[model samples]
Target: MSRPPRILDGGTGTGLQEAGIAIAEPWLTSAALRDEAGVAALLGVHTGFLRSGSDVLTANTFRTNTRALARMGVAEADRPGYVRRAVDCAVAARAAAGTPHALVAASVAPVEDCYTPSLTPDDDALRREHRWMAGVLADSETDLVLVETQCTRREAVIAVEAAVERGLTAWVSFVVTGAAQLPDGDSLREAARACVEAGAAAVSANCFPHAAVPRALDQLGGLGAAVGVYPNLEDRAALDEWEHSAHSLPPALTPEAFAGLARRWSAEYELAFVGGCCGTGPAHIGALAGLPVGAAS
Candidate 1:
């Protein structure tokens, strides 16, 4: 029998909470080692998921970027060490799971501010930060690097370039809303092309509200590159409120509901990889596992 296609797992930092670790102020806590117990607890959660059959594990470096570390008062010189530490945590957890075939992705996240593409650092600075982070991640045992939650095509370019420069396989994932538009109002298709032009191994949408995923995937067609999706589940009330307040959509669905949603993607994109994002945990993944290898839902 042919091997089943891969499904990428998402959101390990918050998933730590489910494993009995409180990842409060993830931005702040990720900088300092104050939450040592939390770190261990979080690592255990990742181990559980790996054992449960996740194809990919993202390192706990989402909020450990230099910009985020600087926000938490970490000295500039110490930021690289924090990133290294985060990568080590994921590596150790994956090793403990005894899943030799599991893939580890070094996660590079948005700078300090998110949801405001306008606040992104300028080209030179953005490139500098991305280069620094991607370079560090490349030196580790990580199998690949994921540039996630990017809201601007410009920022996406910097990340893709960094990945190519280091000769690491990279995936560029966007965070979008109902209309398949990035926070800066750039179309997802444009962003997808930008990543491809910059030499990304794949283009994906992540952390978007559930309702927007299908449309987002529809928009990804014919990009001549691999595409992926990992959406979160938000409650209806929470989704509506967040959309109105932040002008961003919410992803709200039960694990089964999300599985149905995820199942759709498998049939549509041949080069597709599907999984969970925010609000998705082991149950969501379990539901998806029941579907046929390429069945969407």
Candidate 2:
């Protein structure tokens, strides 16, 4: 692990909200692609992360898939347009950042709410939905597809399979429960292995509570694959919804403090990736980059 870690960007939707985008649920990133101003905002966020030293810029397609946008009454035929727009925005951002090395990633979010395990659909449905999303993403210029905030092993496997089937590099990240296990109480180690077996190139976690990261690193380490993390900055009782409450949560972990935590994991796990999630902004990434380089200790 002599190489420096790849500094992935922080949260996109949460970052967008912090940037003053009036985002409504269901449609999510789709609503942001309807105009030039909105597209500029998306590009601005990506460039901000790049300026902060991010090596990868995840596209704002976290909620642009047919299954998610369907909840907002977006027609099936129009979903591809939204996905394309989201990817294009991130691509534009990388171009504008003038960092030829920055890579764009198409994000694949859970078909159901990430926190509610009971709401996870059947395997067939998960396969179909994930494949549909991955198909569109693979056709784009994105360098990879990240299935982030996954809660169940079934869904992780399904998502990974879809991305691999499309010949795209996949990363499957799980959202753990308070007990540091998958939402269904399954071992995170097992989940990571399952995803890897399904062709995921990386096993990681994102949108996890800040405190759960230690346990996540313990599990992600020794998995024989690239490990990474991008955790929320505060402790929340549930992940049912991503509440945009960073401004009010004063005295919470500052960017420097978050960077220290990332430094710890990067040292211990030799993390392949590190960044922020909910409540994390470019400042967090800047602080993280200031730390010493990572090693697979």
Query: Highest lDDT, which number?
Result: 2
Instruction: Name the runs in model 2 displaced over 4 angstroms.
Output: 235-251, 291-297
**Clash count, one per candidate:** 9, 0
Model 1 earns a TM-score of 0.87
Q: What lDDT, from 0 to 1, does candidate 2 have?
A: 0.79
Candidate 2 residue-pair clash tally: 0
Q: Which is the leading candidate under TM-score?
A: 2
lDDT of 1: 0.72
What is the RMSD of candidate 2? Answer: 4.0
Candidate 2 residues 53-123, lDDT tens each?
78888988888767777887778898898889988888888888787888888888888778788899999
Q: Would you list the C-alpha lDDT of every candidate in the order shown?
A: 0.72, 0.79
TM accuracy, model 2: 0.91
Misplaced by over 4 Å in model 1 are 1-3, 19-35, 239-251, 291-297
